[model samples]
Target: MNRSDMNNMAGSPYLLWRVGSLGLLAVVACVLAIRSFSPTARTRQGLMLAWAVAVVAIAASAFVVPEGVSDRALLNRIDPASGVKCATSIFVLSLPIVALLGALMGRAAPTQPRLSALASGIAAGACGAFVFAFCCPFNDPLYVVVWYSVGCAAVAGAARWRLPRRFRL
Candidate 1:
């Protein structure tokens, strides 16, 4: 609507990516929550749907990385020490929430515990990463790829590991 606002948006190309990525993640999380918790036939169709959601989430998150940046440049910008810390912290913070959601869903769907757990894990990871994108000022493609995405995945893995113990009826 205004020139200054337009200028700011133009300067921050990653804003578009952030908005789109978060929107996509939100949708994926909801879809996963619904399908994963529902009692359905443990068939190939269901598994394929889960795989599709996972793949879409991964691909969408990857696109959050800026384009036209060379690998060398990205690598040079990487701060492995800080990145690890950031990723770890985000994952650790998100795990409990993810675990709680998984547990609630798992109680209802005892037929396919693994599938439900996987869906919840992936959804939780996406949700966590999306939230991180807002606070993280760094729009470096490498940072988004390495820490944010990996953080989501780490949360997912941790959730999966804790699935049986916490979700068991």
Candidate 2:
């Protein structure tokens, strides 16, 4: 985005928090997944920790709506079709990252590659949805809950479905 656009967005405290929180979770998830899937092969505990952190972060993001917008405006933003579209696009965009991470985590647990795949998917999905905070102009908390949070989950689900087959070793 342009400098002016960024400045405008930055003016909104809620938007900043929304992006920052999700971004933090995404980074943490990826870090933990990488650690667990590394050559040294950390335990599943790291992956579980990452999943817990991501869940909490997503839950918290539900409250980070843009502060100045009116309730009417917020309500108007609650179109289910648009939310679904937005979420689907986000999930589609994140697939490559999820797949790449899954491949990198190849055979982390020979008997349970699914765990690594799941972690990689969650990381990629969270990061992908976090980017939507920049593009989405709506400051509706409900919007964030439906589109951003659920979108990340959809990405994770999609990744779980696709990654195992693609990354099978």
Candidate 3:
């Protein structure tokens, strides 16, 4: 998004709804991730639960913003890129977070290191999407679903792949 394009959206009337929805999902994802890391709780909850939460969070965040609240013009402006830029931005925003979550989970060394790392990644990805909500003005459900999901998935996948190695035993 260009500076002026961003400036133009300063008063965008629909931001509140998008941010609120994304924020709530982010919180849920974070909670699940944190819980999944607990050594005592690792067995009780595992990869399936982590994935379930991420899927639910994705569906809700995508559909939360209603259709009538915003016009198609904004999306038209962004439609050319097909949200690739947004995905990149979201990934960039979440990278530091992913690294931190990985380090924490690695240190904890839960019984299920792989699962915990995957959960950490999912949570970090959700948070990254949440952080990008401020800069993203497009309320298009399709746009949100496709690009945001990609961005979040990228982070989560990275964490999952790397964190399992922390467990030597």
Candidate 4:
């Protein structure tokens, strides 16, 4: 996008409203999965619920992007490094949450410590991404999926490696 386009959308309430609402929806679902999965129950319901929310979020993103614009075109709006910025932001905020969740899971005695901590880390990453959405100017669908997904995976990987070692079982 050009200067005028950037200026126009920079403070667009519609963009904020859409991203905020849907982003929170995604985060909440992930959190629910984390909450349920951390316990010993290990039911599939919570994970499935989170997956359903993810599907809805992905479908909604098609609408979020401007009609008829290619994914590459969307990056011109501002900050070619927006994906990296967003991803870094995700780590900064989510790491603490992941640690907290991991600590909780350790105390709760999950059936599989590593797996449970990893899942909770993913949810924590989503929570951080949701919080950063307000500050991240880039609203492209590709940017959201690629960088956010990376951030989640990175956190989850770290949690899997770190959290399991803390447990006795």
Candidate 5:
């Protein structure tokens, strides 16, 4: 579609709100995951593994399959053809790297579990934003912040739930 058509597609306020809410959820989930882990070396390792798996899974899903129709409809509000491929690529490349870095940093330092998770989440968000800059160039900033953030959070939450009780916060 033409530029105006693209603009019209992406101008919905509600879509922005939905994406933002999801992003916030992601941040909360990350926090929860970190807190769930025990304050031990093993728990730290577990947390790192959890974040890594979640990031990889979400990023792969973004490309291997179309985002959920509901998600697309929301995204289409910003760009009828959101650059799904680019977004997926960025997510796939950046998330693992960031998670790994966070894991290593956490391992080497005396950071708290919650702090480590939050740090990783922030890194993930930054990577998401970088990916969005190239992929969904026409979409609203809110969409990027929300959907990507939420995706990260979902992974973190799932990891927390799956971990054994001994490792729980």
Candidate 6:
């Protein structure tokens, strides 16, 4: 397919999936940051910082990686279109429920660091899966796992670092 064809393929559904996943990641990261920084005066500020950092990290990674990597013969074995559908479906189905569960559990036990981490991990996994689905036929699964994991970790680390002392449970 030509460049125009590729651009056309990345239309509404793809945009929606990408935007939705990013939004979900932002929400989850914010929640985790808030939980970590509970009782702090700068909780909101910290969350914003975390969000900014996550966006920068994702953007940087995308910019550095060449699109040609996804067009390899082995990578093309998987249907990118179908993969995107699967990933998007998984993300849409999982994020809200996981977010809700995190909120409920967080309210009940605000001091649980492990719980917060688990929530962050779930969000990361969802994002990774979605990215992998869309990037199929053009990238290796291993690359997806590695880069996505790194992206999620960067976000989670930023959230954790910005946590307020009162919320450091």
Clashing pairs in 6: 37-164, 70-138, 70-139
| lDDT by residue for model 2 (30-129), tens | 8866765655555377667776775676567556655454456544767777888778867876777787787776645434456666667778877887
Q: Per-residue lDDT for 146 in model 3?
A: 77
- CA lDDT of 76 in candidate 3? 67
Candidate 4 structure quality by residue, lDDT tens digits, 1-169: 1333556776665466445654765576456645654455553555566667666766666666655445345445434476777788888888878877866775675766655766676677777777776666555666676787677668767776888787776
Using lDDT, give the best candidate's number: 3
Worst 10 residues of 4 by lDDT: 71-80
Candidate 5 on 1-169: residue-level lDDT in tens?
1334435545444334333443443454345444433345344554565456445534433332223433556546444244444445445545663555455444443235444454455445444543343334344443454455554454334322332222224
Q: Tens digits of per-residue lDDT for model 3 on 148-167?
A: 88888888788888878777
Separate clash counts for every candidate: 0, 0, 0, 1, 6, 3
Which stretches of candidate 3 lie above 4 Å from their native place?
1-14, 42-82
Stretches of candidate 2 exceeding 4 Å from the true structure: 1-5, 38-44, 58-63, 67-70, 73-77, 107-111, 166-169
Write down the lDDT of every candidate, Cα atoms only: 0.63, 0.69, 0.70, 0.65, 0.44, 0.46
**Residue 96 in model 1: shift from native, Å?**
4.0
Question: What's the TM for model 5?
Answer: 0.38
Model 1 Cα shift for residue 169 (angstroms)? 10
Ranked by lDDT from best down, the candidates are 3, 2, 4, 1, 6, 5
Q: State the TM-score for model 3.
A: 0.74
User: Whole-model lDDT for model 4 versus the true structure?
Assistant: 0.65
Error of 6 at 32 (Å): 2.7
For residues 43-70, write the lDDT of model 1, one tens digit per residue: 3354465457556644665555555544
